[model samples]
Target: MAAKLEGGAYLSSFVDAVLEKLSPILEDDDFVLEENDSALELLGRLERSLYDVGSVLDDAELKQFSDKKVKKWLVDLQDALYKADDLLDELSTKAATATQRDPDQLQHKSLRELYVEACDSLKLLPLGDFPNLKKLMISKCQSMECVVVPQALPSLQYLSISECPSLVSLPALTLTVPQLEELHICDCPEINCFAEEFLPPSLKTLEVTKCQKLASWITSKGLQSEGLTHLWLGPCFDVKSFPREGCLPASLQALKLSNFPNLETLDCKGLHHLTSLKSLAITDCEKLENITEEHLLPSIEHIYIGEDCPLRWKLARRDGRPMV
Candidate 1:
């Protein structure tokens, strides 16, 4: 019976699978007969109930570990979902054997964008179904652990995920979504690395904030995309130095580092190859002091140092230096 839905992720996955099964059954107009109207109505009501209950499953999953009541409630919910799934499966089998419709007609081709917010119970996103989707934004999904993009999304351009605390890694974007251009990630602390070795080739802008483990991951990975132009990283309290020699790609045009409280040094060897970089901004780094003269590359036209940094006054009054 539904493989005994165990963890929050598994339960959420099971619920999504049931919902997907119900979609085509409910969508087929021919399936709803005059005699079966009552059954169709019951299925419709069941769909609504599932949606209502699914919203809180993420929070409940977390609480279930500590509270026996939450665990029991989840067990009851899993049982109800299994029964609903069984009923849907029986009807689906009858419909498939009775009539055969063209599979191409069932595809959702025109859907271009999708946004999911605060779906605490959603653990996985079956993005392979939406081939034409261009932009996807997911925010505040506390229980979301993975985003499943099984096939290539040729049309996807921009993806932004924020406040997803449980997210462990992203789908291999460089291989899965080759057309992706912009990626913004914020407040997702658990993510340690990208699923793949490299970022998308089409990516131009990358911004990450308040993600300490991910920040360290990015630094260690060397931020090596050839097309990336603008980069912003901030509020990483553990970082003592940044852009460890050859960490940033030479294609970067503008870079901003902010709110790094423990940052003490800026590696000149790391900035040596950035011939295309024009604007550099460093702010809110209170302990920063060691920025040698060679750290300012010849290609840099504008530099901004916030007052909170100890080197602000030193750089401002330094002769022959362009300061802001």
Candidate 2:
């Protein structure tokens, strides 16, 4: 496929502009924003993720690189950013319109139907008995100390939590939100470990970041989910080693690990059990010392390692091709 001609800097600029407009509204105290509104909370997370992408693109300058993978990633990011920009525009209009509405009518506005943001704590009943709710997102609520899943959200298919520094634990997924298909938790520094029954068989995608305590847990007991296809764990400094094969599910197709600064060794013999694995990525693991063909699975088609990785040059392909 031909690469797009647009520059990455342009996309970075667009994201910066979007953040500029959205940040003020998020901080506006005059809007009488409800602390527990789920929809607005989801939007706040979307904004925060966009902001994070903007920061990454600004520093990456992907337009200068001729690599096909980098170009493709940039193109995909541009497409997503355009959609996010439009959504933010609509949200801004709603916030403005809601501000103009009379108090009585506003109380009954449908905008109140979404998830909440910036709550001091996630009590058990944020969305009490939300039987029909399909998605719930919580983000940037720094004071949120715990998450207690509501019992009636059997229909929930997606759940995400980000930037809640004080959040320490999450309820077991098997006990709550059994239908959840995607789960993402990011930048929650205080979370130490997931509940033992954390991986509900219905989940397909899982992503976790910047949770040192959780990273440590993974080292001793890797996640196993027969239904999961994608897994990402990164930026957790406490993870000193990788999990053995018995701890991982055979259904995982793509696995990515990043910035585990203390990681020193990986048991490749243990990784051979992931028969369905297609892609493996190890980036910014500075202490990782060696990676040989024995440590890789024949099923892996794409392997990406950062230049800073100690064993980048040692990683090879089963088919005699370069392993990047």
Give each model's whole-structure lDDT: 0.78, 0.69
The residue-by-residue lDDT of candidate 2 on 55-114, one tens digit each, is 677445645375667667776777876676655554543453343444454432333234
Question: Which stretches of model 1 miss by more than 4 angstroms?
Answer: 1-40, 43-107, 320-322
lDDT of 2 at 197: 46
Taking all chains together, each candidate's TM-score versus the true structure is 0.70, 0.62
Q: By how many angstroms RMSD does model 1 differ from the true structure?
A: 9.8
For model 1, residues 1-324, the per-residue Cα lDDT tens digits are: 223544578778888888898877777776624258888888888888778878998898778768989888888888887677766655543442232333354333555877777666657655645567788898997888988777777888989999999998788898788999989999999988878767887999999998888888777677868889999987777788776777988899999998888989887778877879999999999898887454478788989988888877776676457558
**Residue 47 displacement (Å), model 2:** 30
> What residue runs in model 2 are displaced by over 4 Å at the alpha carbon?
1-113, 120-125, 292-295, 316-320
Candidate 1, run of 10 with poorest lDDT? 93-102
